[model samples]
Each structure stands twice: as structure tokens, then as C-alpha cells.
Target: MEFAFDEADAAFRRDLVDFLDRELADGWERSEFGLGSAVHTDFSRKFVRTLAGRGWLTPHWPERYGGGGQGAWQHFVLGEEMWKRGEPRGPQYMNVNWVGPSLIKYGTEEQKRTLLPPIARGEVFWCQGFSEPEAGTDLAALRTRAVRDGDGYLLNGQKIWTSYADGADHCFLLARTGTVADGRRGISVFLLPLDTPGVEVRPIDGFVGDHSFNEVFLKDVWVPRSRLLGEENKGWDIVRRTLAYERVGAPRYARAALVLDGLADWSRTRGLLHDPGVQEQFGEARALCEAARLLVYRVIDERAKDKEPSPRANQARAAMVQAERAVGDLALDVMGSEALAEGSRGDAQFRNSLGAGIAAGSYEVQLNLITRLILKLPKE
Candidate 1:
């Protein structure tokens, strides 16, 4: 169980870091106009294309799918660097992380031929349409329906808190195809094009930033059978695997760790590092970040070995949420008023930490999973 990176992986990280230093020389910031804002997405579209050109966008995918055919550790390295630098890839992270892989696993050949290339080229944006007004953490409760209509299905429902919907070209949607009594069995996954008729995207103002959330309305939106991912009424398995991939997708601890370093530097510059209280805060936050990083690495190791995603993914995601929250708290405690400035590192970290607890399944949900699956505790 060697934890250190081999020379090849370490060299890849060095090259990636150098490239990012040059690319983000202007100090890339996600807080400038929010992630889904025109300004941010426009930058992401261009930046990701550049990454694609470097064969860095989907390096872990098979080469036939337009990836570099690299190992999973290499892909994880890319994620850590991107997240630390504020994830310039924006919404495309979903495409590379799970969306494309899900398609590769379950999509028809035509579906793969049509969709995989665009994602590999970084020419598209995608959003998840899983969360509904009635189904946030309880995704099986989603009521969005897709009824059989000739060769396609007519979809009607609403999805809320859809991140980056304003910039996405397509949606990885979930809808109920079976009767309401079926619960999770009733659900189906759809690769829906946003331009389809009767689909509307409405922006929602959110504390994170403008356009960070949206309401996606589907009123008799027609999707061809070709767009259905895997088998209808059997999407729960796909969702489970997709969620596993998503749990450690963002590498939030990398950014949190980077934020901790910044705070330490800030403290040192202001002679605040001498204070025992501030010192303890920084040390604790740093420890949390390291612990979270190692937990995530455990999950990635499973992935590298092609193991089924386990409860460790849930534990890793929960640890990342804690690490982010710890660093966010340290920022405000040590930097005080300076942490409150709009678009500042502290402000951005605080907002990201809030989202981290909720995204990729909430922290509480992860604990429930840990209890049931890892600890093998009976359900309460």
C-alpha cells in the first residue's frame, strides 16, 4: 500500500502544474460572475478546449473514446490540479467524470458514436436533472414522468437546483417511467438535448451566485428511444454507480488544502501566526485536509483497480465536506473582515463549503450510508 506517487505520475503532475501556472497567470476566479454565468461559462468553454487539445480532458478514458488511455491516478491528478485552481473546466467536469463513462458502459453504439466525441473534444456542457422540488436527497422520490409515445417518450416534470443549466447543451435527466408505486424501480435516465421543444430553463437567484441554480421545465418534451440510457425502469443501478463516481469527483479537499495554505501565509504576513489560537486553528484545518485527501485517495485506489465503488466513496465525500468547512471557518476566524470581501478567497471558500455539504449527496446522507454499509448497522 504505497502512498507516494511513482515518478511518471509525479512528472505528469509537475507538467500539469506548470501548464496551469501559465494558463491561469491572470488569477482565475469562479466568484467573479458565478459558475453558470455567461462570463464564467464562456471562459470554461475556451479553457476546456485548450485542455482537450493537450489530451488532458479525459485522459483516463480509452483512446478510442478520444482520451489519452492513461491510468485513473493520472485522471485524479488532473482533477486535483483543476479543483485547486478553481475548476476552470466548469460544467464539463460532469461530462468527463461520470456522464461519458456512464454512456460508454450502457449507451448504444450510435449513442456512443454521437455523444462521446463531443465530450472528448470538450465542445459541450452538461447538467444533471436529478434533483426535483420534492426530491433533493431522496432522489427515488422524483416524480418527473416519461410516458411512452410512439417511438419516443413524452417527458413532463420540473427539476430544481440544476447547477450550470444556463450553459449546458444537454441534461443527464431522470424521470419516472413506471407507476408511482414502483419508487426507485420507476425511474429512468435520459440524455436529453436542451433544445428539444417544450423544455424551458429558468434562472434562480441563489446565495452561491447568480445563475448558480435553475428550474428546468419539461412539458411534453419528446425524447427519442435512442436517448434512453441503459434499460428503462432499471436506472437505479446506473444512478448508484454514477453517484459513486460523483462522490469524489470534485476533489474539494485539494482546494480546501490550498485555501489552508493561503490562510497560513496570510497569518504569517500579518504576524497572526504567533497566536496560539490561530496556530491551533490552522493545524486542525490542515489535518482535516490531509485526512480528507487520504480518504479520497483510498476511493481512487479502488477505482484504479477497477473495483466496484464501495461505501468508502461515501466516507471520502463526507470527509471532503468536513475539510472544506474547516478551512472556510479558519478563513473568517483568522482573516476577520478581509474574509467577507466579495470574490475573495475566503468568501469563495465559504460558499464552496456550503455547496460541498449538499452536493454529490449531502453529508448526512453519507453518514447514513457509512452506518448501513460500512459499519453494517441495522437501519433505524
Candidate 2:
């Protein structure tokens, strides 16, 4: 349980820092929840390809898959440096995070052959389709349906709040293949080309949504049975497992840590850091951030040892309340009057922290898991 990085990891961190220095010196996102949208311009896409060429884009994956084949610590350190630099993470996220892993784990050998290399090369863009209009938190309650047809399945219904749908080339999806009465029991996971005939993506606009999501409709869009992941009706199991890995998303704790650092720096410059009241607030936030870092490390270690995070993962989510809220509150403290600015850089961090609370999983549910599920408390 020594929290210190061993020599090997220390060297790996140096390698990561050097790589970041070379690649992101031009500019990039540095936090896990790094602020702002991608330029998504041609220049940006080519810049991502340059990362691919350097073997830095998918560093978490094995080398055979066009990655650096590095360990989690190296990946974590690389992310820390990138977000701290205020640069966008680029397409590396969808590839190295969970999209490619899920496909590699559950896809057919042919499917893997077709999908993985392209994703690793930054040739394709992907988005997730787990949450439906009615089935976000209770994923099993999803109402999107898929029915067997001639050579494939006819997909119908809609997916809401799907991130990056407007730009996605494909989506890793969950659909109801059976009766709603079957609930989580009847759902299955599938992959779809977003431009498949009969499919429509409608941009969802709101004053505050930041355009990260969309409403997607599938009007008999067909997917070949070759696209079904794992066994039918057993996708619930895969979904659950996949999501555990997915939850990391390069570790919210790491990026949120940056926001906290920014707040501390601002406070010190403002002389608020010397006040007892402000110091207490900073100390509490710092404690939670440290706790989150340890909790995440435990989850990684457990996975490396081939165990379910289970209660530990639950604990990580619970601790996220402290981290995410503290970042949001930290933003208020940092920007003060500027926290309300929609276009200011500091205000952008505030908005992003506000979004972080609801993204991945809402903090409210995490609190319930900690108090009710983990502590074994009776429901109110």
C-alpha cells in the first residue's frame, strides 16, 4: 500500500512528460474534465494524427493496437500534464479510454479487425449510446428497441443525451431486444454506423448544455447481426462490466485536481489563503482530492489484480461528491465575480465543474450508494 511511485513508474512518468512536452507544446487540454469543446477542424484532426504517429495517442492500449503499451500510472501522468496545459485531449479519449477496449473485449475477431486499428489510427470517431430518453440512470429500463430482420436487426426508437452524436462516425449502443417487463434482462449491446440509412441525429440545444449531447432517432436503421456484442439478453452483464471501466474516463479526480490547484493559486494571490475560514475550506477540499486519488489508485490496483472494484468503486463514486462539488465551489472562489462569465477561461472551468456533477453519474446517486448501499443504511 505504499502510495509512492516505484522507480520504473518514475521513469515512465518522465517519458510521459517528455512526450507531452513535444506534442502539447503547440497547445492542448490538460485535465480529465478538461475545459471546452474540440475545434474539430481539419487542422485539429491532423494534429491528433500526429499524436498517433508518435505512439502517444492510445498509450493505455497494448502496442499491437497502435498504443505506447504503457501502464496506468504513465497514462495518469500523461493526462495530468496534458490537462494542466489547457489543451483539448483530442480523439485519444475515445480510443484509449473504453470504446476501443469494449470493442476489443466483446467484438468478434472480424469486428475487431475492422474497428480497432482504424480507431487507434484516429480514422474514426465514436460516441456512446447507453442512455435512452427514459433509461439514463436505470440503463436497463432503456426503451430503444431492435428486432431481427433478414440479414440484420432493424433498430427503432431514440437515444437522448448521446454525446458527440453530431460528429460521431459510430456509436456503441444498448437496445431493448425484449419486453420491457424483462427489464435489464432483455437488453443487448450493439454497434452502429451513425450515418446508416434511416437514422437521424437532431442537435439538442439548450442555453446551458454546451452542445455535448444530442437526440438520436433510429427509424428502422439496420445493423447486421455481426454487430451484436456478446450473447443476446446477456448484454446486461457486459454493460455493467464495461461501465465499470468506462467510469474512469481518464479519472475525473485528476482533472478536477487541476481546477482545485487553480483555485488555490487564485486564493493565495488574493490573500484569501491566509484567512482561517478560507484555509479550512481549502484543507477540506484538498483532503477529499487526496482521498479520491487514493481511491482511484485502489481501483486500478484491484483491476490489475483481477478483482471487481465493487465496494471500492462505490466508495470512489461517493468521494467524487467531495471532489466535484469542491471544484465547482472552488471555481466560485477563484473567479468570484467572474464565475458568471460564459466566455472567460476561468468561468469555463466553473461551468465544466457544474457539468461534471451530473456527467458520468449524478453526485446524488453516488451519495445514496455511499450512505445506503455501502453503509447498509435503510432507505428514507
Candidate 3:
């Protein structure tokens, strides 16, 4: 009957909130600028180091990998608090959530020794080179090629919409190692250092915010075979699992809930709280946020128990997208023109929600996955 955090977790939450309160007292705003913006990334580099010192950056990872050796719930708790404040950890969240974990599972011992420590220490930034112009969520359609060369592979292709690429030290890149006919079976993953001889990163301006996307061109970039992750042609499995982790990685509902609270305060101040329609909107948005939170918790619970990720990740991602959209709609509907003011909660939430449906995996993709994986619906 009890659905509350246990005593220890509750206490941990209290302590973490206190720490975040002090740490972010200086008015650090991620909504005004995107997470990939120079301002945000600059602060994150300094801030994440503090978290690393506290053993919070990689608490869920193994101790040998420079983590605190905590359980998954602890990690989820960290994510929730960070997300509530627009995720001060920046791109490093990818490292802690899925990237580093992927390496842990598939990286060679040398890779782990060389890579995991820097990530756990918050000394590096990573970008994903998954989606290309030809491939979005359907990763199998990627055209980037990595041909076998003398003791390495010659990587040549371009990746679009690579977030954080401008600031990244490395990339978790996927390339085709087989013929186009091979589909998903022929792809391979590479731990690509961004400074490779033929790699070029170009910034792209987007409506979401500044520096939110980039294009990475690989012109016959030579990567030693040692940089390859897992086995060639076996990257699909890693991608699948890594994506499941990334689906619910951000604890987006936490920030959505925070925005909802701000909306409530804004409503209360404008005397709109007494309006029945406003009340209904607030109630609906709150419910959606809570639903997302619970769904994400279910996924985290499975992780805590060491269960293989399932369709629940898709369900959770769908709920989060719904929650984000609902809160954004509520902000605009309730606050009207005031919500459109730059850097306001409404403005930020609306802009952020627009991307929520598209990021990670699109909301429609999650629905398709749910139909096939959870509901067992036949695809026509």
C-alpha cells in the first residue's frame, strides 16, 4: 500500500536537494539557452566535477569503473533531482546513463581503463553519431561506411543532428560494415575520438535554442581496430539496449513537474487559480506528470532488480512525451501572451516540449513499439 521512497532514499533526496539548492543558487538557467549551448556546457564542466567529487556522477556504475557502486534507484534519484533543475550535468548525462554503461558492457579492458575513469570523473563530453541524413529513428538505414583497412577501418560519411558535437571530446558512432542489403545486421559501433584527422564538426542553428544540433563529417577518418566497440556487425544489439536506457534516461517528468509547479504559482499570482477551466488544466497536467513519473519508476525498478529492459521503456517514454506536451499546452493556454515571453517558464517549456516528442525516439515510434511489443498488435 505504500508507494513512497524508503527512509534511506528519502533522506538521500533531502540531502541532495539541499546540496543542489546551494550549488545552483547563482541563477543557472538551462531553459534560456539549450543544454548544448556554450553557457550551459561551460557551467556543466565545472559543476559535474563537483558531483564527481561527491561520488554522485557515476553512483550507479561499478566501483572498479570509478562509480559509487550504488543501486539503480539511487541513480534515478540523482537524475530526478538534476532534471528538476534543467539538468546541470549537461551532455555528461549521456555518459552516465547509457554511453558509459554501453562501454562497460562492450568495451575492451583497455577501453574501460582509458575511458570510464574520465567519464566518471566528469572530464569528458560525448556525442552520439547515430542518426544520419538518411537515418533517423530507423537506425538500420544509415549509410556511413567503415571499410576494413590495414590495421583499422577507414570511416567515411556524415552524421546529422549530432547533439553536443561542438563540445564533445568523443563520439559513440555507428557505421555500416556490411553491404546495404544487410540492414541492421551489418552495422558496427566505434568509440571515435572527435579530433581524428579527417573529422569535422559544424554547428547548425535550430529553433529549439542555440547550438542544439551539429553535423559531423568523417572523411576517410582512420580508426584503429581497438576503437571498435563490441564485434563488427553486432552493434545493433548494443544500440537496442543503449536506446532502452536512453529512452527514460533524463527523468523528464521531474522537470515537467517543476514547470507545472511554476505554472501553478503563476496562476495563483494572476488570480487565475480560481477559474474552473484553469484548475482543470492544472489538474490534467499534474496528472500527466505524475503518470510519467510512475512509469519511469517502473523502468527504474526493473533496472534495480537487474531485469532486462522491456517495452516498459517505450511506455515510459511515451508517457513523458505526453506529460511534456500537456504541460506546454497548459502553459500557453493558461498564461496566454505572457507565456511567450523569452526565458519564461511557459516559453521554455513550450520550446522544450516541441522537441520532447522527437528526441530519444519520436513519440509515434514509441507508440508503434508499444503496439507491437506491449499490446501484441499485428502489424498490417
Candidate 4:
């Protein structure tokens, strides 16, 4: 289906572009740092609050949920402009990509009323706590358990690779509510306040940045029963949807587009595009980016049609994930050691591509999801 934005959408994009241009001026654009930083500067948070005050944060969420009450198309246009300008999307992305929609779908009305406004206003930061020591790739094998108590669930387990856990106000985590025999059926989802007693957060340093990931240790932490998302023993199902929401809806592909545009600009100045080999590689990168764009649009079309879009989501996620890695590899070929520069986010596409394959789910795991869920191929 054709997914171009309407005239109204174009106007919306223009307004957002203008606002961001003003807000992210000299000494201010740094507000758009990624999740894995060791420190999130006050200026960045202030910029997010500014965006929130203007009603642009979580723009895709329902009107009743503190969102701008926009449809998906309005968002696509905004993302395109922001990413093309090499802007920061972390806060807005996390709010719209997974958290807001997840809360709307499964949270209690009280939870919705309590969380949505703060999230949209950028008053609260949320982290994802899903992968564990033994459950990174095999998420169903997670062993963190939440035992039902009188007024809350007692949590005792460790979640590794939690993004922004240190600075976050809360976490959306998956904990076991039953035994191994129950497989994925015994999982429970909860929104746990990071300040709760018995919860300890340890920061992890990653290649490009810190605050990009963390290790969270929960020891008999008490989370009120009201924090449960959806029903008990239903978290695995919730996660399946949440993961899809994260992978498909995030503006990852748009970021890739921005980096590609950078690569083109760099090549023009360096006279690299005139080289036959460089030109050929550049064409390949552009084509891959367009393919990713098409995949993203397909999923968006499915959403507009009110379909679950699970398989299409898988396709888009896998394609975009691979595209990041590929863009880096191509950039390395083009820039070589110069790709190691410390400025401008460290080689732009190359550094991002280097991490893209390993971030979220590995490209291997994403491929597995596409193969099993989308292709429905027979297993050995």
C-alpha cells in the first residue's frame, strides 16, 4: 500500500522541524544522546522536557494517553525530518516506540493515568529490563522470578544489558511467575520502580557509550500488585508484542537514511564518488537503505489497516537491523582508519553499524524470528 503522508502531515513535519531546529541549536543538540551513555546531561533532559512541553514527545500515543493524538503517518514524517537532520531520537523514540503503546494496551487505568503524562512530558525516564545472564538470546529461559505475596510480588533475580537502568524512573521487566515446565506460559510483566527497596543497579560500559546498558539486581524487591501489566502468567505474550513494537516502530531505518546521506556528503567533498569502486559501493548502500525504507513502510501500512502486522514487523526489524550493520561495513571500506575519529559520533555510519548487529537482538536472532515466524519454515 502507498504510505505517503497527506498535506496535513507535511505541515506537521514542518512545524516539528522548525521547533527542533530552534531547540537543538549550538550547544544544545547534544540533548539527543543514545541510551548507553555513562551520563545523561541535564541539558539533554531539559531539551526533552522542552519537547514534551511542546506536546511532541510520545506523539504517536493516543490522545487519551497524553500523546499528541497523531496517527502513524504524522510520526513517519516527523522521524524522517529529524533523523535526516542527524537529530537525537532516544527519548521520544522510547516513549513512542514501545512504552506508551505497551502501557495503553495492557496497563491498568490508574497506571495509564499515572504514567502517560509524565512519559509524554519527559518527566520520567523508563528502562527496559528483559535480557538476563542466561536469557539474552533465549528469552523464554529467563529465571528471574516474582513470587506472589500479600500486596505485591517479591522479585529476586538479575537482568543484564538493561538500557538506561541507572537513570530511569522505572523499568518494564519480565519475571517468572511459574516453573520451567510452564515454558513461556508462566512469565509475568511488571513496571518496577527503580527506587524500590532491595533493588540495586550497576552500570555497564559499552564500546561507543555507557548508559547504553546495565545490570540490574533485584533481591526480594516488593512491587505493588498494581504494577502488573496485563494478567499474571501472561508476560511472555506481552513481550512478544513489545519486542515487535520496539523493532518495527523505532526510527532505526530513518537513522540509517541520515547516516547514508552523511556518507554521500562526505564522498562528494573527498572526491570519492568519482571513483568507480566508491560509486558502486555507494549505489549498493543507497539501494539497501531504500529496501529498508520499503520494509518499514510495509509494516506501517499493515498498522494503518488495523492488522497485527507481526510478520511484517519481523521483516522490517530484520531488514533495518541488517541495514545498520551493512552500512557500517560499507563505510569502513570507504573510510578505513579514518572511521576511528572521535568526533561527530565517531565515524557516523561505521560506528553505529558496528554496534547495530549486536544491539537489540543480534541479526542472527532477528533472522531466526523472520525465518520461523514469517516464513513458517519446517524445523528440523
Top-lDDT structure, candidate number: 3
Model 2: runs farther than 4 Å from truth?
25-44, 342-345, 371-373, 378-380
TM-score leaderboard ranking:
3, 1, 4, 2
CA shift of 369, model 1, Å:
1.5
Candidate 1 overall lDDT versus native: 0.90
How do the predictions measure up, each by TM-score? 0.97, 0.89, 0.98, 0.92
Compared with the true structure, all predictions reach lDDT values of 0.90, 0.71, 0.91, 0.75
What value does the lDDT take at residue 191 in candidate 1? 98
Q: Give the per-residue lDDT digits (tens) of candidate 1, residues 298-353.
A: 99999999999888999999999999999999888887898989878788888887
Return the TM-score for candidate 4, rounded to 2 decimals: 0.92
How well does candidate 2 score on lDDT at residue 13? 70
Candidate 2 residue lDDT tens string, 213-255 = 7889999888999999888877887777776665555466666
Per-candidate clashes come to 0, 8, 0, 8
Candidate 1: which stretches are off by over 4 Å?
none
| Per-model C-alpha RMSD | 1.3, 2.9, 1.2, 2.3
Quality of model 2 by C-alpha lDDT: 0.71
For model 3, name the residue pairs that clash: none
Q: Worst lDDT window (10 residues) for model 1? A: 25-34
Candidate 1: how many backbone clashes?
A: 0
**Per-residue CA lDDT of candidate 3, range 181-229, in tens?**
9999999999999999999999998766656689999998999999999
